[model samples]
Target: MVLHDALSEDHVEELAQLLALIRRGSAVTRSELVQSSGFGRTAIARRLDHLMALGLIAESEPLPSTGGRMPRGVYFRADAGRLLVAELGATSIAAGICDLDCRVLSSREEAWDIAAGPESTLARLEALLSELLRDHQAKVWGIGVGLPGPIEFATGRPVSPPIMPGWDRYPVRERLAKRFSAPVWVDNDVNVLALGELRAGVGRAHSDLIYIKIGTGIGAGIVSGGRLHRGAQGCAGDIGHVAVTDDQAVVCRCGNIGCLEAVAGGAALARRATAWAREGRSGYLQQRLTEGGDLTAATIAAGAAAGDTGCVELLAAAARQIGDSLATFVNFFNPSIVIIGGGVAQAGNAFLASIRQRVYSRSLPLATRDLQIVLSSLGDIGGLIGAAHMVVDEILSPKVLSLWIKEGTPEALAGAHAGN
Candidate 1:
């Protein structure tokens, strides 16, 4: 009901610091909290009690110590609330219902067209969420969505999304908030993929990494200093439009010529494969194209696996081209890891090897020295998990906590928790 019993600024600051310490496992017991936070014993005890009362942190079983008395481990209460996530792509969508910890309770994928615009796609996603929430009997504290285009992060609206027609500047947050009674977050789908990898996949080890998605189109998600970097206009990693060739013949979805996506992405590779088959360069690819009615990145990979040189060369060239762009990024960002994912990444080791070879050979020695080029560990569901994580991060931040405290923990804020 938005009732007010506002917390003082000092109280809110102390809560935020304590929350971070507990969540990050830097401090658990009163002694540890005192040492890390430098708060007096009474202050630590008081903050801990308040957090427990707010259903934010919980003390689990004590750790087994070598010789001293055991101390209980304080952890964020993941089960306190739930989140709904929709990971949208150019041709499909994956949605999930997850806990505050980003654990997927129930998840599913369905074929969808981003070109179908926001209205129909949003409705379908809500329908899926409704079904899942009903079955699980879960209440939503927040909702997260990853769209296959640039998003105006502050407003949760698409901005000049080439693939998402009729969705430009659409009020995604406003519409979704109205329907679900929760805060909503939106971002480019690849950014979420990077996030999913960071939390649940290979990115668990490395703080700095570049996540490249080479599907129907190509995009990169840059994680710098362990955080997703969405640039000034939320198009920081829009590398698809970056020119790879000067040839005027190659055209991209955004109508630009020689863009990387037009020359080396899955769609581009498939188009090249088809042209080769029609020209009878590879009889195997020709027969497969005839049988399947079209050539795709997957089919081309299969052909390459079956010893088709043309298919192999096609992939190698694409990989080299992609690697050239990646080399530039590696030099520019000097990330510790470079994860390649999506349809083209699944084209087998040869494709990966070619890209790695090109990147290592082309990039500066310093950047390449510590860089580890690898395939995505999350595979298909990374975006969904990332979306959930994004919402969870927002709902639990200091500002959101202040809002909640000011509102006296309304029903919508019941399960929300965060730190400074």
Candidate 2:
């Protein structure tokens, strides 16, 4: 029996076009789909049948043709299944599920303990997924997990990430795959966030985009030619370690000195705030210390929003550092849009304005001319959505389709299983 891989390498080009046409909300006749997809009629018919059977596509009523026989049109089912996503942050993990059209289904936020390590954190993640999936037994397509550090793309394992300990070469994909008994994909958190933005966030309008995430750590996910550039080893956007300030005093999580993250991450901001409060230099943060609240990125952002001058200054400095590093990226990639997100991005227009001004000032005139610098459109949802996007993209691959059809969907189809 042949496996039910949805799209093979040969069918990828056509699948992409079909997805595009369906996404456009246009009623497309077979002839139109063929012309747009450049696929032979038989091939297109076969693929369309597979997609229709999978419930990803639906046939609309036949449209009347004035001068010819009526042709049936097809469109994408935006609510096929809920895509579950977990956007792992430095201090927290935001879990969300969405449908095919990238609309959020449900989301939950949980705190992270720095000393918890990978095993403990994974346990928490397992609990979270268990609860979310059980609650919505139907409509869950798969699970997508985003990490706060560099991930080996091929193996879906963490590769000596700086901030996250006890996760080196962790078999995240294998573990998740076993738990869900479904496709599980792992990716660098920032890259997934960028992908989320590319699909439905602010970067949607731009084909070439660069997404930088500044939080407890800073990194980027570069998208060029309408695809994410993961570099040779999936470490392409490790800009957090990029030297910016040249101060050899402070150490970074990546075992480096004077790194951009060391100077501008959320932890750095909190440390500076704590130092100022200890010196009695800032009364704003002192109130927090007195109240026994941990000086974190969220607290600092709140302080800055409340007219705390010291907090504002610290955030501005971080923005400057981020802009300086991005200037290099701007020169190298020259993407049409650059999006910044993460905890720091919650600083609102003040943070965005500062970064935009600096990037424009530092980048070459030609590079800056058409560049659009803005905050992330997905906000906190970027990571979750990106994770879901990864799973969806993979499950739609030909190889996965073959295996799933051979092992899972066929039996499901035979038994008339109502898979959500």
Candidate 3:
């Protein structure tokens, strides 16, 4: 039942602020809430009571005190609802069910092709989510998705994603909202990875950072001032298409010549490896191809590990090209750290060393002085966690919270503030 008539807008705002404090673990007691929110003791008590009545927060054991009265610890009710999240890549999908605190309770990963089109991909994803949700009876508060393409943040639709054919302008959020009766948030996969790292991985301590994913394609997620920075069109960090060379012999799937992804992405490296194998320039690659029928970036890395000079040179060349492009970003953005992830980053230390060498050599001195380039610590599950946080952050924002606080459940507000 709606309680909008009982609470004033000012009261709702105050309640949201109080809830935010508790949810972030910033204020764990009545006194802490009063001090953090600058509210009178009575006002803090009233807000806490309201949140507790709504089942959004609860009081735990009392804190130790030196004086007379002990304060009970206020905590967010993380298990009150569940969130469905998925990270969709060029050739794989990772889906999970998370609690309000963005903790994964269950997850599933499968190899699937995004080029199969949005209809088939989303249908398969829906089936996977259904399987994960089958045993749980928790309320699904929201859905978050990370796609391998540019997205229109306001509409949650893809915007001419080159690697994702048949996905341009697809209604991802709308479809998912209709399917599950929950609001959905969609973003580029790399942006999701950046958020995951920011909240759960190496980026937790650093406010300004860049997350670069070198998979079938290469993309970047930029975080400035501790927030994901999606530009005006929500495609700010699309470094994959940045032109790195004037050569026209190499054409990108985006119809561009010598773009960074075409020169150094996992797909590009594999394509080059295949040519090298065909030309007999790499005996190791030829043997691997003859056995496996196709060469991949992993094959090249394996050959390099086996001391194949041609494979090592190939890997180094791709790394140097990627690093050269990254040097421009380092000089311009001056991020505190640059995190490398995705399938290509798994090529081992030699690939990382090559990229680091070029970045340090080509970047400005001041930028390189304090810069730290490292691999992603979260590995494959980063996007799923990021997707969970994305939805939680939105659902818990002031405006959205105000709309749903009266209802006690965001289910009534599904798709109302989606993509906003």
Cα lDDT, all candidates: 0.85, 0.77, 0.90
User: Which ten contiguous residues of candidate 1 have the minimum total lDDT?
Assistant: 411-420
Q: How accurate locally is residue 139 in candidate 1, as Cα lDDT from 0 to 100?
A: 66
- What's the residue-level lDDT of 303 in candidate 1? 87
> Residue-wise lDDT of candidate 1 within 1-420, one digit each (tens)?
112324777787788888888876778877889999999998787778778777788888988777779877678887777888988888897888998878888998989888998899999988998888888776677889999889989878899999889999988877777777777788999999999998889998888989999999999999989899999988998998899888988989899999999999988988898899999998878998788777889988998999999888899999999999999999999999999899889999999999999999999999899889999998887888899889867766777777775543323543231100
> What pairs collide in candidate 1?
396-417, 396-418
**Which candidate ranks first by lDDT, i.e. highest?**
3
Q: Rank the candidates by lDDT, best first.
A: 3, 1, 2
RMSD of each: 3.5, 4.4, 2.1
Query: Candidate 3 has what TM-score?
Result: 0.95
Which candidate do you rate higher for TM-score, 1 or 2? 1
Ranking of all predicted structures according to TM-score, beginning with the best and ending with the worst? 3, 1, 2
Local distance difference test, candidate 2: 0.77
Model 2 segments more than 4 A misplaced: 1-20, 23-27, 40-43, 62-71, 78-82, 402-420
